[model samples]
Target: MKASIASLTALLVTSITALRPVFRPRAAAAGPFLTQVDNETWVIGNELWNVTQGRTYGVKLYYKDHDCVGDAVGHYVSYNGAASNLNWTSASIVTEGTIDGSSYIDVKFTATEGDMHWIILSGLAGAYQYFVNHNLPTLGEFRTLWRLDNTTFPNGKTDVRDEALPPLSEYISTLKVQDETWLKPDGSGYITKYDFSSWIRTQTYYGVYGENFGSWYINAGKDYYNGNHLKQELMVHRESATGDAVQLNMIHGTHFQVSATDVFPDGKMWGPWLWYLNDGSKEDAELRAKHEFASWPYAWFEDEAYQTRGSVKGQLVLSDGRPATNAAVFLGDSSPNKTALDQGSDYYYTGYADEQGNFEFKDVRVGTYGLQAWSNGSKIADVTTSFLQNNVKVEKDHLTDLASLEWQVSAKTKLFQVGDFDRYSYGFQYGGSPYEHGVVDKCPADLTFTVGSSRTEDWCMGQSKLGNWTIAFDVPKAAAQCSSSKKNATLLVSLAGYSTGVSSNVYANDVLLGNLTSGGGIGTNYTATLLNDPSLYRSGTAAGEWRYFEFPFDAAVLRPGAANEVRFQVTRNSTWHGFMWDSIVLEW
Candidate 1:
């Protein structure tokens, strides 16, 4: 019996090995011969090559020793083929080799006939290590080195080289570590404005860095009219003199004056622009960039044209007569009757209130503008109210002191609320880790959340097309109030992200309330959820902006002194149709 069992096991093992595809290893290269196409993508023999179906092709990836550290044992090749429904398949084997005194990772895989075929080489430094150069603006951790087409290559081999980058000193002359306070927003204890401006000008006069330095420019000239020209520069450095990897970005532009009668004409401002420096992750670097961008037209500018700019100051009070502390206030162009909530293409200025609700916009361009303010629900209780004051005038070298702007809440009595109003869905389940895809697939099929008993994890961050989500809650005095008088119920929904062209049908106790259509599509949640590396789609907090809406329904639909269910169902049948809620409040 033992002999027979061993024979059967041997037969099964032989059958599985026979089914596996075999790949031949390529010989070591004599020298580096790969041609560069772009920063990330590269080619082998020629700029273009035709791929033959069912033919095995060899791939070699060369990298510097310091850039990545690991043997090529774990390195493998993968391809996304259109013929295979654009599915990603891994190569059977990987091997280590050397070329011209440099280390190279090698793999072999069969090609398929497809309209779009992307060959991906990865696993250079093992899991969670330095897979690709972080300085470049490449997508995700893995690099897509080649794209297969109907072109032929010599010996059916694909090879690419990663050249050593020059030091940061080569780009900026007299490089010195900036004071830590210069990176702060308050500018307290920082160097003098004149000294900082002089340092910035010296860096700008230096010619643009090379492609190997990961430098790019943004032309703000086309966006803002009225003869306003602004040029921005962004660069990623591998390491500084202190051996710390730092990402540096700077924006410097000339400012012009706008008449008070004009609507601020978007983008007209004055200042010596600021620069951001960080040694954090890519997401942290982006956040720093956003802060520097918003803090434009620095009040300390010594420019002659900027000396005559005025300031706007005011206080914000909520409907409950409480100071709206830490609220975000903005002065935007009033030409098209647009407010801060509109998020128009016109340029806008942003500021925040202090603990006493006193907010001020410094160095405001002499012009007429619209003032808007909204609380992020940090200091005060969450309320679905916004303050807007139009026809605000700011004169040259004058302080425009406006009256206290009061925010009026829509609903009076709030029965219950789900999630916080911080303008993000990070409080709910599957919200913090947005890098994963197929989040909806991993969620419960029928999510019937009980208000008091269910925790935040019970509520998914986004609604899926698979089915409707039900919220169950008990309102004790609902029946008694209905007997005396008919009170309307208001549903306030604050969305952190959403898909456009999709509508959600809301119901109370099986009765129709209203069909809510999403405003704009600012996120790729639907498409990103389908990919293996969903982290590639993540843009941190820049993924989407918060949008607020109110839905009024008949109070009779909600059961009194009993279990009440609010159902939300998407009208569209698509994986991409969804909404990420920041908060949902039921008010009477």
Candidate 2:
């Protein structure tokens, strides 16, 4: 009996010993097994763990708080490519822990086939949101914690684990411009980098070259105007294959100021710049970089032809003997019988008169040029007399001074005017944001305004699709009486912008004045479906140039010492017909 009992005890001990080995936990594998596939792609598993199609895999990201802002929350990850089933919202945080000194997060997702090309990360840190892109290192890098430092290297450099990466200039030197010259628009001529560079160097400006992630860029500095001006800066960029080339990219207006002269103010500089070129692939980044490098220190600036420049200075005075302050002056190629404003394929230079009405164009190319000037202020009377000065000669290293250019008014007497002549619908109702469809539909059907009592805001910004606007005024006994000796009254309608095939029918007391159409203006066909929302047209932003429509009518239409009405109705043609009015004027 004792031997049988001892045998049972021995058997129980053996079974317990075998089970103890199974319950003991094995040591966890040491990680981060990361391998870079390209600039933006990475392999996250060990060599034996292959990424197979239609399988599940674990994704781990190690993030270092280099800025020490705080731990980023609200993590999001996405798998890119057509084959990948995972999206931005698909992957969720499964676990969070620290690996070495860096914060690490683990996420689980179903693996895709060959179509899984990229992984993107985004999260919030303090008031700012941080984006981590495999391609855009400027935003942030997930691999090895690299960040951009411009002061250390030109074209920017990235540091990985305390090691500095090579600057973008080192890579850009290998690229070459394949075409001899790029064809200019309108089939006018061909343009080379030399042509652009030469013109750029003539202006006093600041510049810088930097890299954001894998993309390279050049900030050619802002224009003479300080803030929020149209076409303010000149910029060139070499974007990555996945980068958005259409979106305007901005930089600090003052941070990268490399020039001694302060031409632009300290603020955010807006972009789309002047030029944008894309790198077709990761390997093609160098090729795109070539254009940005070529413009820096613009080689053509060294040529004697570019160095030889002259200056043009002048003062503007209105016919009433008042200084035309803030008038815009332009210089264009000397073409006989052509105004500077009409030149299409010439180097254009612009300047503004100071408060004292004095203006000057510096570093102008040595050549004869046609000069044109116009007041920036709203005109009370018709200033239709041409200010075009033909064959204004400029010699090399000399100043061409034309003291006091006179601007004459076209009409002998002023009758009445509605809205300002500032070539914009800024002060009128809905003018501040008029780039939308269905604005005319929202306006009052019987829109009427009395001339003296009506404010600028009472006028609608634009008319569209058979909409009509009425202007009411009392005709004085002396001015309204028709006489054989008096000249015929003239009506002028100025448009800030318009759609194609737009026209207006003008009537005085139901007498047809004329069917008015745009003489010359910026025309666009907004083909998008009318959503009746503000975003239906141009996203509520202003663009394009002004046009004029004139009508001459007999003054007999006016009744002496009585109420008069001048009505304008858009000619019905198509659904998208429209025009933004700048001013309406009547003169005798």
Candidate 3:
């Protein structure tokens, strides 16, 4: 039988001692919403809905019946107890009754619409998959009730059918390590006046270094018309132990804000909606309080108009197409009041948009401002100034390209042996003899070797003269073991003894290997050389025995593929006690 390959050995070990997979609910990083042709039918949860605001988009909610008693005709009262056809906002107007005995409530707004960018529809009492469509919006007489009743749905409870409702993960997935997180404010954090005035302003941050940075305010209280309004800033903070990083360890919990765009009980506030959304609903308050991470309640995005430029505007999004919430927007260039556009200077201020992904630049000069939005420590989106037409002289408008950015996920490393938690007590010590072999004395009785989950007490070899102990195991020719992605691969090798610090030197066909160099103290290297084979293989402790001594070479020269021989070489210098090694896998 042929000796098993190194990659095969790694695979077998991993398989035999399979670790339970951790099911972490991550945000559904997806592609952004590409702008379809105007009025095209975009499908959300499989129910096709018409896009009304030209190509600019907004979500909608419809109801065909208010009460269970309605039977296709006759007038009925709405939840608000309104008589039926009372005009409210631009889109919320009660019109004639539908065959299902329900009045029509149209919701119309676009990403580019004025301050009113989004709407929420919460509190659908016992609503199931089947709902009635009373009418569709257009610019005609604006009065019609076309009922599409009893639309059967197979996965209504499990799938999200509304365009306004973000994915469950989006609402719950906290900013993970290396993932970007944009900061914004909850209106309740700051004190202010005016129920809905464009008068909110100011944002201040106290860095870890005791430095407080403040940015100019853009949109005022008027912009935060509904949902709990407050001045806020969208800052991007990285996650780290020493620096100012915003980490999503999941242990800290995800932070989000409730938006007016979400459906809520009537007469409720609107802002950014946040809470643990395990599957679909919010997380339990009692349990969440203990495990969930709370938003930085004191930090508020200013609700005051800090400044403004010549009609400059834009939007922001993540690389994965999700809206980059609460990012700070800034302008780079500006023009003197009524002066030539080219001769303008740059003015800068910051402001964040509401839940629909909007923002404003205050005190902005009239020329061209490099439109940049930042969240946490990362840039959300950046665009150049636009000067389209006369009426649109202020090139600032809806930014559609943001919906195309996507975040990339990186791969993680494998080897991890360097005494993970400082629990193992041992180190390298000096002995009187140089070539007479070192020694390891006084090993603790509780010493144990653990790989994956299998534990064993098979450690052999005495302590080094320096003091630290060691362990080694021969590759069982009868066993199939090892793994790797490389092709035309070869000899497998695994052994743990005393290293200068942490790691082993690997050799292949005596060519001097070149892989696994930076693999920390714990490393791996495989080969396809002879000496380690089957049918004509040599066994027992012979030439290859001394060929692989404990403390053979330095870690600086080890490589992966070209590695033929594996050995443990300890350093004679340093007062750093000693080190231990165990459980290695190698094959041919």
In the range 43-151, model 3's lDDT, one tens digit per residue, is 1110111111122111221122111111112111121111222121232211122213322221222221111211111221111111111221111011111111111
- Give lDDT per model, in order: 0.41, 0.41, 0.22
lDDT of 2: 0.41
| Model 2: residue 327 alpha-carbon error in angstroms | 1.5
Steric collisions counted per model:
5, 2, 111
Question: Model 3, residue 243: what's the lDDT?
Answer: 23
* lDDT comparing candidate 1 with the true structure: 0.41
Q: After aligning candidate 3 to the native by TM-score, how far in Å is the CA of 213 from where it should be? A: 28
Q: What TM-score does candidate 3 reach? A: 0.17
lDDT of 1 at 509: 84
**Predicted candidate 1 versus true structure: per-residue lDDT over 1-588, tens digit per residue:** 235223322322111122222111123222212222222222221111111112222222222211110111111222221111211123222333342343333322222311112221222111000111112221111111121111111011001111222332333323321311121233222211111111111122111122222111111111121111111111222332332222222221111011111222222331222211112123443454354345444332233544556889999888778898887677776644422333323345666788878999776667788887776557764756777788888889899998687788654666777776655566577764522223443455457888898886777777746468888899887444744474678777777655443456777788776665544322321211210111111211111335566667777777778989888766564343356667788887
